[model samples]
Target: MTTGPSGSVLVLTNPDDVTTDLVLRILAERRVPVVRLDPGTDLHAGAALTAAYGTGGQRGTLRTASRELDLTLVRSVWTRRPSPFDGPPELDGQERRFAASQALWGVGGILASLSGAHYVNHPWNNRAAEYKPAQLATARHSGLSVPDTLITNDPRQAREFAALHAGAVVYKPLWNTPYAVDGRAQQVWVREVRPHEITAAVAACPHLFQATVEKAFDVRLTAVGNRLSAARIDSPDLDWRQRQSLMECTPIAVPDPVARAVCAYLTAFRLTFGAFDFAVTPAGDWYFLECNPNGQWAWQPGPITESIAHAIADQLQKGPEL
Candidate 1:
């Protein structure tokens, strides 16, 4: 498929994502060619794909429905979550697994090979930012205040750290794995832990223990291509995520140093966009918690949504600074 111009935004997402929908609407208003795709499902359904790379050049095409997207014309590729791969039904269990893996690496590699197309948050960068310990350490080094943290596999060390923090420590999951209890999806939230609460169960897997930040409120800062939108969130629960219904979100100015730190943290991770979670104290100090390289920002109220949409569109049009 030959595209008209070398200027198009290829969205790697689904129709269900309102965030991507909002951006697509904005791009449409600005009269930009957009090729939205759901790679996982489409790759197996009927979407035809052609990817190639050699000394000659690298290029590909992803065609779905009646439209075709020339991979070479893509200026930006939004790497949002799409439906999981469910291959052809005729394949047996092992065959299905093998096909799925091959397709993931084959087609997925092609998408990743779009070096000219700017990724909002590159896949490799996203994988690197998943390490919470590394994130905290980097944030600290970049002049951001971070809570005292401990990652341990030994039960004895966990208790000692809790003691060192005067039992003001909280336990959080090292990985936010989707879990279900009683047929209901469950999310692990940060909660205060007592020394006695630390037990042999912690030895089963690596657990993160940290000194709980004295929270006057929580801040969710979404940064897109040098633009930072900060929202002050006030909640009544120890874990604000658990009491989102009781939370209030409002736009606020990010402190100068904190803003610099946020930009530095993004630069450190080599990400064009990031959602930073910070704990604000009564003393007016900010403590960095973590940075989700490809975090969600659609639900953020006020001007944040429109501001981010424009930022994303402008970034795509301007191309990568790197």
Candidate 2:
């Protein structure tokens, strides 16, 4: 698997992430020129400044002034999970300086320099994808079933929504804001909402209450490029993440229409990859919950991981046509 003409690709990521390792493995197996930007001292501001900023930002001017320097071009860059210094105390003042400089100069500057890079998922795109309400609208437009949802801070509206769903409503946070007080990972799950609970729920923060579908199985559909992989996650719990041991996840193929909807949602978000959560009823109804652009996929089984790696590498080596 030799890359004929595609030049080197610089993957901006931490050395520790399994996704990074998986991508690097794919590129290496294909004999693709891959440069890794890892954690720590490597992020120090030097070379780029020496080139982009050095000699008053002019290579031709330096030559005219009798200064020697070599000008090289960056073909492409892939900004994966950017690695920055961990603890502030672990790094010295200068090291901290380098990290700050890197954000503005190293990370920010390098990405600014490159004209185009096949971003598997760009930062701004990820930002847009995080909007759950927006994703819900997009999913509905793509012919996917979405549960009736009501988002408001009014207590009366909340009570009415719960009454409509007949106490079969679920209250969910718009975002996952987890904090560790001791060593415990306190997860917030969408629990069954009672009409009496609506008053407090509305007081929380613009409650996003939805009709809790009696799900036959929860589906986590991961889409990498045009390749789609589905997993049927069965758990007795409403939110499977709360009780991992009770859940069973098996790889499965999505229906053609459902697959198309997933791809359409990805396109709407301008994302190359997405992890979509769906609720399937006993009637075989697939309801769109949300799609996370930077969702976790490494924990998935080998086949899924391999396919994802292939999709990413194919896109990087070839083009979007892959």
Candidate 3:
């Protein structure tokens, strides 16, 4: 195998991710060595990795179609939205399952174990931060105001909570998953819930309910390293995502307290990057909604998008100090 360059940046994400594309472009301009690999699809399609560890410490090499990477020389890793591992088409269901599991434990573990590589929010940390309950609690602990919330599988508790909020609560899914209706893609958007709507079916699964905030607008704060880029989102819909085309996005300065709290939240999760959502009240209170550890920032309007991309590239280029 040919030797790859030292101090390479390893980017793990799907090919179609425009956000990754922007950062890659900046890295290219800066002449930084980057090896972009989608472990899910590339592993079985010409990509290869070999790792070994003893008293001498870990050593490995990963090869893609056009670039070879010295695993030990990797300076940083971006664990973005990589696809799931898949086996060859010829493999039967059981065999495919086995192969995928092996790839996940073997390949995934090695990538996670890269020594001295700065992670823009490691995959393990991302998984931990994905839990909404943990997010709400962490936000609260970090001195950020979080809406009064409830998570329950009991119908009685659900009804009581809604009644307690005077039926001004909104129901949000505990997590987002691939959902469709009659072949059309569907999303579970936050919607108002009434006490009378609480049914026995709620007992089937845990549900998240929060008292709706009286908001003037919303904020999408993208954090890379110590830098933050925030945008004010104004929309008529309760969920801004539902009417993104109708929404207006303008650059906004993050409140000092909110910025400090966000940094604390990232430190709490051991994350170097996070995309935080906040509901800003007319009275100037910012209510913590959620934080997407590996959220998209390139979609933001104006210079905020490029600013965020530059910040991300800067982190990857610098990596971690050995």
Candidate 2 vs candidate 3, TM-score winner: 3
What TM-score does each of the candidates earn? Answer: 0.94, 0.81, 0.96
Select the stronger candidate by TM-score from 1 and 3: 3
Local accuracy of candidate 3 as per-residue lDDT tens digits, 160-187: 9999987769999989988999999999
The C-alpha lDDT values of all candidates are 0.83, 0.72, 0.90
lDDT of 1 by residue, 1-322 (tens): 1222356777787668877877778778777787888887776668889987789887788888878888887888788776656556678898988887877787677887786788876777888988998899999988999988999999999999998988869999988899999999998998899899888998898999999888899999999867899999998988878978889999999999998988888889888888999999999999998888888888889488789877877766555444
Q: How far is candidate 3 from the true structure (C-alpha RMSD, Å)?
A: 3.1
**TM-score of candidate 3 against the unseen true structure:** 0.96
- lDDT, candidate 2, 1-322, per-residue tens: 3454455666667656667788778778888776665423343422232335575553311121222223233334455776644423457778867656655544454453444456667667877889878988999998889999988888888888888876668888888887566988777787888888665546667778898887899999988877898888998889988887889888987988898888888888888878899999999889999898878777677888778777777766763232
Global local distance difference test of model 3: 0.90
Candidates in descending lDDT order: 3, 1, 2
Question: In order, how many clashes per candidate?
Answer: 0, 0, 0
Best by the TM-score measure: 3
Alpha-carbon shift of residue 89 in model 3 (angstroms): 2.9
lDDT at 90, model 2: 56
Candidate 3 pairs with clashing backbones: none
- State in Å the error of residue 110, model 2: 4.3
